[model samples]
Target: MKKPLIDMKNIRKTYANGSLEVEVLKGISLTIDQGEFVSIIGSSGSGKSTLMNIIGCLDTCSLGEYLLDSKDINSYTEKELAIVRNEKIGFIFQKFNLLAKLNCYENVELPLIYRCMETQERRERVLKSLEMVGLSDRLKHRPSEMSGGQQQRVAIARALACAPPLILADEPTGNLDSKSSNEIMNILIDLNRKGVTLVLITHDNDIAELAHRIIRISDGEITSSIDCKRGM
Candidate 1:
């Protein structure tokens, strides 16, 4: 059997301020397999953001083992972590985070360009990713010209263009309307169906329930984890 895509053990995070050390995460351990859609739901001040930062390689835990794609990420240097973030993981934010001056195609192609991918392959990835999000026709349109749902789709396309093994989405639908939220969620579900490993950070239970597994966090610890078994 293939090893799980994410394997974390006894994870802990703490922040130090002068003489005070505040523990933000307390002994969190979880494993997510490849192709799994998992949601981590927590309210404000729950330490979920800190956990997300650690999972995304933007921060490290004070104590614990975190293996992503079977590699021990906690052992990597800052530069190595940056490379992992750029080449192995794709990130989607609540804000679309697209350049206002760049059109849809250009926005999606930006990461590939940074990777110095050959032009032909870069074009193929951008076009294929846009097609996946049903935005192939909006290639030349700017984010200002699209609806909220469309802009989020473009964001998803940008993440997909990297062909990374993991996708980290933080409140991806937070800025959209109900219709647009549903649209974005459905697109995410479809992507998971096609074998993308996605970890969604959200506070909305209704939105969290859409994922196959729901992990609830509170007071810097995991309160509960439910396997919906709703069929992946």
Candidate 2:
């Protein structure tokens, strides 16, 4: 069997006030294999966001182990974590985070800049990513010139431009209409079919149903994990 892409064991996170401490994650553990599409469903303040941040390497767990491709991340320094995030994970937010001034192609090209890829290589990747999302013709359009759905597509393209092994989307369809949400979900499913591992956080069951696996959280703990392939 292929090795898991992500292996998190007994993960825990806590925040502190002056005289009180709050535990956000209560020993959550999970393993996600390569090319798998998984959704985390929970209500607000359910620790879903904290878990996503940990998975994306944006934050660290206060305890337990997190291994990405067999490399333990708890020991990594801030700079190392930054490198890992840039090279191994792609992030999409509820708000389509795009630069207002840069055109679509330029926005997609931004991640590659940090990697210091040559100009030609960056251009090729940007174009290919844009084409993958059916936005090849909008390469020159700025964020303000596009609709919300188009902007989210641009965000996806930007995420893909890095060619990262894992994509972490936090409420990706939250800002779109039902039609646009369907379109975005279809694109995500297509990407998963093409072998990009996806981990998304959503409150909508309809959105979660699209994933092959669903993990539900409540009160900062994983309450259930359901494999949905039979239903699919």
Candidate 3:
């Protein structure tokens, strides 16, 4: 049997509210297979973002067993988790998260630099990922020089440069117009077609339906996990 890329069992997250305690996740359990495209959908205050944070190793669940790539995530130290985040997960944020000072090429190459990749190899990856996003022509342009769509493309290129096993996209089209949203979705669909594992977090049902599987979350719990590939 092929082991799942992500496995979570009875995951929970709680936050302290001064004298009170609040639970954000209520014993959530899920799995994502390699090369699968899954969308997690929910409205605001649904704890969807918190779930994404745990999945990306950005935050730890208060209680649960999470095996990422067959390793126990809860057992890993913070530094080890940082390494895992860098090598195994690519993140696309709604805000783009590009540095104000860096140009396109520099921004895309940042992760590779953290990995201490050789100069020539870093050059190849930056160019290839930028080309994938149609941003190779804007290598020298800074974030201020581009529109929201273009900046999002640059962010996508940054995520791709690492060639990570999983991509975590959080409302990637939230900042874009209709045409730009479609274009970004097309790019993501193409990436999935080429065997990239993707987990998209969105509140829009229309966008969620685009994935191979749809998991609807509500009030810190998953209401449904549907295989929606047939609808495509």
The TM-scores of all predictions, comma-separated, are 0.95, 0.97, 0.97
Candidate 2 structure quality by residue, lDDT tens digits, 133-182 = 89999989999999999999999999999989999999999999999898
Stretch of 10 with least lDDT, candidate 3: 223-232
Candidate 3 residues lying further than 4 Å off, grouped into runs, are: 230-232
Candidate 3: tens digits of C-alpha lDDT, residues 86-202: 999999999999998999999999999999999999999999999998987899999999999999999999999999889999999999999999999999989988878999999
In model 2, the clashing pairs are none
What TM-score number comes out for model 2? Answer: 0.97
TM-score of 3: 0.97
Q: What lDDT is reached at residue 131 by model 3?
A: 93
Instruction: Write out the backbone clash pairs for model 1.
Output: none
lDDT of 3: 0.94
Residue 116 in candidate 3 has what lDDT? 93
lDDT, each prediction: 0.92, 0.93, 0.94
- Which pairs, if any, clash in model 3? none
Error of 2 at 77 (Å): 0.6
Name the regions of candidate 1 deviating beyond 4 angstroms.
none
* Residue 179 alpha-carbon offset, candidate 1, angstroms: 1.0
